[model samples]
Target chain A: MKTAENAQLALLLEVAGTPKPGNVDRERDFPDLRFEHFLAGTVGAGPGLRAAEEGAPVGESFERAIAGMSQQEGGNTQFGALLLLVPLVKAASANENGDNGDAGGDAEDAPGRLSPEDVTRVVEATTTEDAADFFRAFDHADVYVDDPPEDAAELDVRRGSDAIPAVEERGVTLYDVLALGDDADDVAAEWTGGFERTFWAADRLAELAGSAPASATAAQVYLELLAREPDTLVAKQHGEKTAESVRVRAQEALEGGPEVVEAFAESLVADGVNPGTTADLTAAGLFVALTRGEVSV
Target chain B: MKTAENAQLALLLEVAGTPKPGNVDRERDFPDLRFEHFLAGTVGAGPGLRAAEEGAPVGESFERAIAGMSQQEGGNTQFGALLLLVPLVKAASANENGDNGDAGGDAEDAPGRLSPEDVTRVVEATTTEDAADFFRAFDHADVYVDDPPEDAAELDVRRGSDAIPAVEERGVTLYDVLALGDDADDVAAEWTGGFERTFWAADRLAELAGSAPASATAAQVYLELLAREPDTLVAKQHGEKTAESVRVRAQEALEGGPEVVEAFAESLVADGVNPGTTADLTAAGLFVALTRGEVSV
Candidate 1:
């Protein structure tokens, strides 16, 4: 029972990670919610819903596949696009101290408890760029382990990629992007074009960074590029790349300027990305990455 | 988000329908514990982990699948198995009114918040039998709906059966017990034989019963016959009559006293059925069906 109780908390903290002010203490109480069990049940029944939405399968095996996975661990955990963000969840709850919690132990074996102060520091240390870094690095690392090192730069990416085919199959798109089929190039080309014309040329220049900013902000570069090729495959790639770039640039810009982080985040809000969504944050990271030349499109 | 949150809580409360006293209100904080996202994750992952340990396709797909489900809407909620019993959990936090502040609202609403008083009531109201009934009924019910009814007797069995095929495929023994194949007859025979030996033949029953008072008190008489002859197959011609007889016997015994309930449950326990496992719980339910003449063992 002690294990069961603790297991509940462990899972919730794992998913919710850290808590921000105004948000629930995700890691603290979320496990007590039993959200996964509910998902298993709903999703287990969702095939019927899926059957109703899409026509029923000719045989039971299709439905069985979904159900077969249901009670299987993480059967109902698929969050489509949100899944990519899950790798950073542990980092959110992880105590930076890496202490083992024994007074008799050496400094290396100190307790790893995250105090409210630690929570504040970690939250402060975390940024959109960090999150993107998490995604990029997470794909290449063993994010799941008994004692995942705090600074393991390279993880078993092959192993991580091998675990979730959907990540590859979907190719970052929330839908069945991997199943683009024979017309993959055509569909990719068109979406790419739309991405360039709509989000890049228009949204970026007009709303994000203006054509002529005070300095060569990554956001400014993003705006300029979109202006050059409004409707092209390159634009779409640039758009996503630009967001990633902006995040990186912004973090660098904010170094030693503690006050600027909040402002930069708010600017992202003005640009229409939900701070909660990964794309917007990625864009913020792109800023820092572009400025530092750490990543280029 | 609200509905998702509520659904998460509902799932937890459902799973933790009944818990022992001190077990519900845990003292530890969330990150301080080790939570299993898949309550059945360990059990479900059992095969996968074993397979991995044995050098099988320790592929990321299986583990990824489990991890995905770990953050499922219901997974991150506060209501996991023993986790919900924690007094601080919002689901268990109630107002002056006895309402689990958030329970009856849609899954979109917060989970009917359970107050300490409400938690106490829920804990008191729930028995192992009640918990089993909840799962069986949940098995039959449509989990996608916003609010699952509180009354287990009112659940739709046919719809519940819809989930059966999928559960069968997953081999989730808890909800899939009724789905045994050719070997079911053999297993059923063994179960019945064990029941007869443990309950019907035991003359020192009173002594055993008195010794384990908690166990003895909740034992139901009809549950005894259920313990002995679950899954007894009767010919179609005699099936209805047999089922009716069992039902009559059950109703009459239920009318006798709580002691009958105690006796029934005690005998089953003495037979060594752990209610935590879905297979055992379902088997017990089968016992009830047979004893009540609902089905032939």
Candidate 2:
């Protein structure tokens, strides 16, 4: 529950931050998901996340978050972030037991730090039901996704929970579901790749936020990530070429600085270009930073 | 725990809403109380507030919130808000039990809504220990307040828990301590007067948020309250005349519409005027709106 809040608070910081170029901010509200929807979603998800801490499966908690967000018009405001947060929550709980020297079985001698392997074990242990709940969550939200690969046509997320039986028939795990789309989705990629980029962003946020404000440091990290690579969600919504061009514009904004970043934000909003994948990454980064003590509060 | 989150979320929303005329908003942060500090305080206070719902004294939860806020450099970011929220938390819990028809005693015929009497009963029931915790809370935070009146010299808030003996000797309860400042402090007034303005603002917020956004409605309610009367905190820090002048300007700003409100915000920020008491009330109002179902997740 604490880790989930850490992620949401991190998300709120991201939402309030300016000059990241093309996301809803304190000054601008998306037509569907205004800042309030994000607030509602974060708080609404609190109960289910807390339930997970007490032994509920991560998928059920996640579906609860989706239902919670569904209360607002903005259907899937934090789907990507929630995907990243769930395993982290499990890992943190394990770390808590490890710290108290009570994690006697598989957790024996686990380090104080919530490890990548801790998250991996948790994600790998997810059941077919978990996978179905996740698909249902997608159906409940207006999440944007690229066309499924031909070989993975059954992976149509819009099918919602109806895809559950097939998932069970194939004996596919939630990990397999993520592996299918890891190539096309950054969030899916994190799920399959042990969340490497999120950890990297967390380290960067902690080091930078120490000297400046969390909001400013969060923005800097978001821009750095966006400039380094094109956001996959942007590629999915707009074409790959446009995503690449957007990354180039971010690079130019970085080269020119804050004023340039502000102008770049203005242009992106005017052009209706939103790099949502990067924002999701920022939320995951914030979660990692908070749990890892790189970012306080 | 959910109620604590509700209170804290209301506080964060209050802190973030902009053009609020004089307090910190998304675009601005206080040097002492960073928005992060407020975030930390809210989350840190969670456990104790939850414990209160399970039967702990409201004072203990309030003190817990203070301890939580003190962990940050910006001590007491929401002390006044906490004062209002602690009682509300208790009221909400009682309301929950009443809803289940398990409230066997005084709540036997309680209505669907959380009443002013519910809050007053919860508050009036606080012990002398709560008063001591409150004093300790004051000592914990670098809160802004006027010089103590001569008759109440021994009531120096700086005395911390050390004042417990004096409080006990005088047989003064938590209600009495707030009553001491009731005439001079808006937070204290809320406690003594059944939170009349907060409920009023909550009604206004529900009405307004239905048409617009919760953030916009919260900001609007704040401006209305500021325009209606001089804030007691402002009157304390800058004296009655300056506070009165601030109120006159707020009234004029209301007459001039949102553009004038924007201009008023700019002037207030530039001139170092912060109507903190008004912001605290807004937090309370938001809590009422949220818990009352006038606002939703």
Candidate 3:
């Protein structure tokens, strides 16, 4: 109980205080949750914020609030998502309202719903995203991608960034969860599996990029591989119409221009192949594309 | 330089995907910077997020990327803040463009703004926030909150709770800062000087509560003591409302009158007194008075 209280107080201080040097050295002081939770939560909150800003139904209000949050200046999809959860957690912990199985009121007004015990439980559980999942479970909100309105997106980002460090130590990968191969739907399972897979894929792509000569084919192969992944956010941003346009523009810009291809390739090598950025950019079809879809480990 | 690159890469990996727990414990992986800089730059990205959500400006677009991070989440605001500074610092070092102005578009897009040599400079810099501050000094965005909002006053209950550890460490008294002979603002000035001052003041208030008998006089004294200083968010929250309304509410709610006062004092003693909360409550008159202005404190 004391630990829970301490943790709560610590979190409040962290949120309210300046990001100091002491926190970097103090393991216990960092954000205790996972990074994706921040991303998804903030992104998720985008929808909720839209609702609130529009004065929609309470549920709708929450959804729009999340969406509007994503559009705001912060639009840190991850943090915005978590901030949306705060109210949900506070409400869900309420005494069932004696009727509608949902949460009740604020933490101060509603005691047992979010008790010291619950806070402790959250602390004991690692990962920012996981804590978000638990809160989601408690609140029973679903995850879908309708593209949280711009402002909602911004708010989600703010909240996610604010709380991403807590679970930095959990070491969970998004690619692994994605590699669970489309069967995973639940947020927790899908997120973890996808993280692992993204890493694995990113690593493989980097290796492939290494051997291939500086050519458009190599870039195309990298881009194709990145495109195959199934993260909705990635899909929406990269595989959608805008992404296709960017890819075509980039491709056309280099077509029949062997000199440009070589120059771009040299730049890639000189820059030392940041696999993550390359993969993301490839997915987004910003500049280079890889010819082959399959990469060997 | 190597450390800066590694820290930057680490943050990119961690934020871009799911990071590993093992990676988080590896302190050497992250470059040392001042805490304040980190708060203002990377972790301070919170403002960017807020701006993004509100659609305030184009510069906030960068902030949208860092939402959903915190000490509790795997976001690693500490490292992320540092990483954010890399580009800025590198831009400073890369003067090839001959453009010294701090416009995001002009400098951010400049070729070779961030380079291996600049990365090295950042790595060699001591203190996390300071490293971050190096980048921020050039781009001084007003992110910190200097005063409470005018319409709604803040309530800082956590200050009371935070004072406990400091009080235990330093055997000092609140009277040291108060010096009773001076004016109230002077008392406030000294009281808010540092952690020690705040802690001593809270401790002294707790001690006074313990000694005073449960009565209207005791409550009045509590109000007076709280009124002497108001530094936290909680105190700010009370500043907006009329003091008389607050006093009347507190006075009317005391079911057992003096007995209630005694019980409240006992709770303070037992809990080690949370000056942050108590002070705000007292000032608001929620804890003692019925209306704002009825009680000066």
Candidate 4:
């Protein structure tokens, strides 16, 4: 329950951070999605977060979170964030239950912690039913996506529930589904490649904690993450070239100070260039930091 | 769990609503308390909310909520809000359990509803231990209050744990503790007066549910609430004449339009006249509307 609450707090903090270039924040909103929608999404996602904490399968919890999140007026607020959070939440809970040998002790006396290896084990254990549910969740999320690679069209998430048959026929577990997209999707890559970026961001957040307000720390982590990599959502929406340019801009903005960063944020929002994937990764990092007690409330 | 989530959401929504005169909202923050502090408080308050759902005693849950909420840097983000929420949450859960005869049927199939009488029962059943805990919660909350009335000096909340002896000596239940302050404190008045204002605000929120954005509806309800009565926090801080003048200004702002309301918000925040009690009442109303499903996610 503590893990679930922290995950929800991560979602709230992620959205509440100001000057989070090109994404919704307390100060900015996309035309169709306001700040309050994200607030509502955080509230709606609670049950699914609890499901993950209670040891439900990752894909089922993700689907449930997305379904609940869609109850808000906004079409999709935290789908990608939930994708990263569900497995992390499950792993944290599993660690608390002493599933990991190193985690042996009175669980109540020790804080829950997360490791890439623990999360990796969780994704690897996913069944084909989990893949089907993952696809079903896309129906509720209504997230923007480019056309799938021609070869993977049969497994495209845009197919929603219809893609379940192909997933089941191929016996593709949730991990398999993510593995197929590992080359192009940052979130999927995290699942397949040991969540290196998420952990790195978490470490950065821990280092920066208490130096500034929590929202500022989160915003800083977001900018640093964006500077480190081209945001996959931006790449999909615009092109690799545009995404790379955005990353360069983020790096320059970091050097140029708060005014420059604020300007960059405004420009991105004005141009409809939302670095949503970076935001999702930052949210995942926050959840990890919160669960590990690196970031105190 | 749903009831607890809604109550938490109510806290989030209460803080996120923009143009709320003299209170921390998305666009405004008091120097001592930033927007993120309230976010962290909402996260921190979760365990106590869950305690309420699990049927913890009202004062014990209230103390637990305050202890959790105090983990944030802000001194008192939702002290009075929790005062109203704890018993309401207990009552909502009790209704779900069919403690109220009219609440028959599968609890899962029916949304939980709150009634003044039901909440009154929850408060009236409180024990002296609950009263002691309620006083103890004030230590963690750090809320502002005027000196106690001359006759009730022994029962001052600022005495914190020290007042427990006095409370026990008098055999004062939590209800009795609240009843002592009912004449001056709007929050305490709700307890002894059967939550009339909370239910009325909930009905108003239900009436305004979909006419605008949820935050906007909340702001409207807040303005209506402020215009209807002089805010207790304002009265305590600036005296009755100033509080009544603020109320009159709120009424004028309502007739003067959004720009006028925005200006009034700025002026009140500038004067450091926080209508905190009004905000607390608004939060309680939001929780009631949310639990009853009158305000959809």
Best by lDDT: 4
Q: Report per-candidate DockQ.
A: 0.02, 0.39, 0.02, 0.52
lDDT for each residue of candidate 1 in B1-297, tens digit (9 for 90 to 100): 121222223223223321111111111112211222323222222222222223222122123223323432223212112111111121222322234543454542333322223333333332323223323333321222222224322232234444444444443332123112113232222222322222231222232333422112113322333334432232122343553444444455456655664453344334332222122222222222222222210
What does candidate 3's lDDT look like per residue over A1-297, in tens digits?
A: 111111121122222221111111111122332222222233334334333223222333333334432332222223222322233232222222332132546553344332333222222333435333322232233333333234333223224333234223434322221223234221222233322332333344445543632222234434343334333332343444533443443354346355653444344334332122222222211110111213211
> Which has the higher TM-score value, candidate number 1 or candidate number 4?
4
Q: In terms of TM-score, which candidate is strongest? A: 2
Query: Candidate 4's residue-wise lDDT over B114-174, tens digit each?
Result: 7887788899899999999999998887889877779889999999999999999989899
Which DockQ-derived CAPRI band holds candidate 3?
A: incorrect
Shares of reference contacts reproduced by the candidates, in order, are 0.00, 0.36, 0.00, 0.70
Where in model 3 is the C-alpha error above 4 Å? Answer: A1-142, A146-231, A234-239, A244-297, B1-172, B178-187, B190-297
Candidate 1: which stretches are off by over 4 Å? A1-7, A10-118, A126-297, B1-181, B185-259, B270-297
DockQ winner: 4
lDDT of 3 by residue, B121-178 (tens): 3233223222222223223321212232232122111232233344334432232212
lDDT of 2 at A18: 67
Q: How accurate locally is residue B58 in candidate 2, as Cα lDDT from 0 to 100?
A: 77
Error of 1 at A152 (Å): 41
Q: Deviation in angstroms for B85 in model 1? A: 25
Error of model 4, residue A180, in angstroms: 0.6
List the candidate 4 regions with Cα displacement exceeding 4 Å: A96-98, A101-113, A146-153, B96-98, B101-113, B148-153
Task: Summarize candidate 2's per-residue lDDT along A112-179 as a digit string, tens digits.
Answer: 55666667777878888888888888767888887777887787777888788778788777888888
Q: Model 4: which docking level applies? A: medium
